[model samples]
Target: MWTVGHSTHPLEDFVALVRAHGVHHIADVRKMPRSRRHPQFNVDTLPAELGSAGIGYTHFAGLGGLRREQPDSVNRAWKNPSFRAYADYMQTAMFAAELDRLIALGAREPVAVMCAEAVWWRCHRALIADALVARGEPVLHIHTPQRAEPHVLREFARVENGRVTYPGEPELF
Candidate 1:
């Protein structure tokens, strides 16, 4: 499994970056899968572009971010509301289905999950990677052709029932 951000890289550069990792499938994990800053990454154009390069493209909107935090979210370790919300959503059946799809795809193809952020640590992909890690899937975060790194699960995360929760020990905190 791989994570990539469509940062401001030009289309060719982005293509080259994925090709460098021998990526065969690009999973767009963007809720809207459109980019105003980089119109080339918009859903319609992206598939054709990737196809021309022999890379398959699929949009897994179910795994997309921008989730709303539940009123009673248990993931208090994430100070960022967006991160907390995504961590909370990771327990849902929808997330599980999408995650299963991603894992299955990884088993069958060189799949990379993508969003718009440039850095994995700051992106919701970090939490997504955590869930994947818990499931025994090795995740790699791609920064550039020569800059991919193995994922390390966040220190505060705990896996339970194949899901991730960041409920830090109250007594310790």
Candidate 2:
């Protein structure tokens, strides 16, 4: 499986990048698929644009980010509130269901999980990749048409029974 961020690329360029990686399916993992700054990437228009280029797009809002962190979150290793919130969400059944769906799709086709961040480490896709890795799936981060990097689970990540968490001891004041 592969991951890529639309990252303000022109619609044509994004299509080309995915095609270059032999990606037949794109799982849109953006909580809000619409991009006001890049109207071309709006949820309503992306499927057709990608379809015209022989690619399939599926928006998996269940796998999307923008989650709210619990007041008592176990994934405290993530310093960023957004990342921590997403890590917390990963523990829910909804995320598991969507992840299963994505895994099944990937098993059948060359799939790339798509989001809006320019890099995987900076996006929740990294956590998703960690989950995939925990399941023994190989994941690659597509940086460009010619450059793709193998995904390495975050150092702070803790995986158990195919689930990932980022736990840390609270600092004593």
Which numbered prediction scores highest in lDDT against the true structure?
2
Structure candidate 2, residue pairs in collision:
none
State the lDDT at 112 in candidate 2.
Answer: 96
What global local distance difference test value does model 2 have?
A: 0.93
Worst 10 residues of 1 by lDDT: 164-173
lDDT of 1 by residue, 1-173 (tens): 89999999998999999999989999999999998989999997999999998999999999989999998888988889999999899979999999999999999999989999999898888999999999999999998799899999888998887789998645444
Q: Give the Cα error of residue 158 in candidate 1, in Å.
A: 0.4
Stretches off by above 4 angstroms in model 2 are: none
List of clashing residue pairs for candidate 1: none
TM-scores for all candidates: the values are: 0.96, 0.97
- Per-residue lDDT, model 1, residue 137, is 91
Task: Report how far off residue 13 is in candidate 1 (Å).
Answer: 0.8
